[model samples]
Target: MIKLQVIGNLGKDCVVNNVNGKSVINFSVAHTEKFRDAQGNQKDKTIWVECAYWTDRTAIAPYLKKGTQVYVEGAPDIRTYSTQDGRQGASLSLRISNVQLLGTRSSDGEGGSSYNSGPSYSAAPQHVSAPPSSSQLNEPADDLPF
Candidate 1:
């Protein structure tokens, strides 16, 4: 079995459709990487991956909006097709098995709300704990021997 994992932002909102009584959510993710070429020039390359999640868990579909960051793992597939100009092209696609929300990009290109799809596959806000206080940090360690 082959699996692929991707961390990127969604290009657009997800669409939920029922195909013969099975629910499928379709979306796309864009991952951009920055690298310096042999000439010492920096360049940004973006890869777009189409994703399809076949599951009864459609509760999280509303949060899969454009510019929303996510982590997805699934089986990868490459599809080839002929372009209008008679050129061959290929696209990457995924059959999503697991997906988690990272953050949302605001209109100003900044991070906004964040969520996570927990075990139940529900869209819920993640819990963040505060750092320990100075007094707590000064406490002695436990008496457990090494």
Candidate 2:
């Protein structure tokens, strides 16, 4: 089994469709990478991935809006097609098995706050312990061998 994981922002709002008695949520994600070329010139490249989440759980559709950050994991599918000028092109798509909402972009195109619960499409809420208090941090390490 080949699994692919991606963390990026959604390019547009998701669409939920009912096909043949099944529900599917379609969306796209864009990931950008920055690197220095041979001449030491910095460059940025962005890749867009089409995603399809076929599941009965459609409650998260409303949150999958444009500029929303998400972490998606699934089986990847590469498709090749002919362009209008008879050129071959390839596209990357995913059969999403899991998705998590990270954050949303602010109205001014700046960073925004994250979701408090951090809900996942295919899993339940995980237990996350709170950070240690100042007193706890100041305590001696009684179990240390040193």
Candidate 1 lDDT, 74-97, residue by residue in tens: 999999999999999999999999
User: What TM-score fits each model?
Assistant: 0.76, 0.79
lDDT of 1 at 26: 99
Model 2 residue 69 lDDT score: 88
Candidate 1 root-mean-square deviation in Å: 6.0
- Clash totals for all models, in order? 0, 0
| Model 2 ranges with Cα > 4 A deviation | 108-122, 126-146
Residue 129's lDDT in candidate 2 = 100
lDDT of 2 by residue, 67-112 (tens): 7889999999999999999999999999999998987776663445
C-alpha local distance difference test of each model: 0.88, 0.89
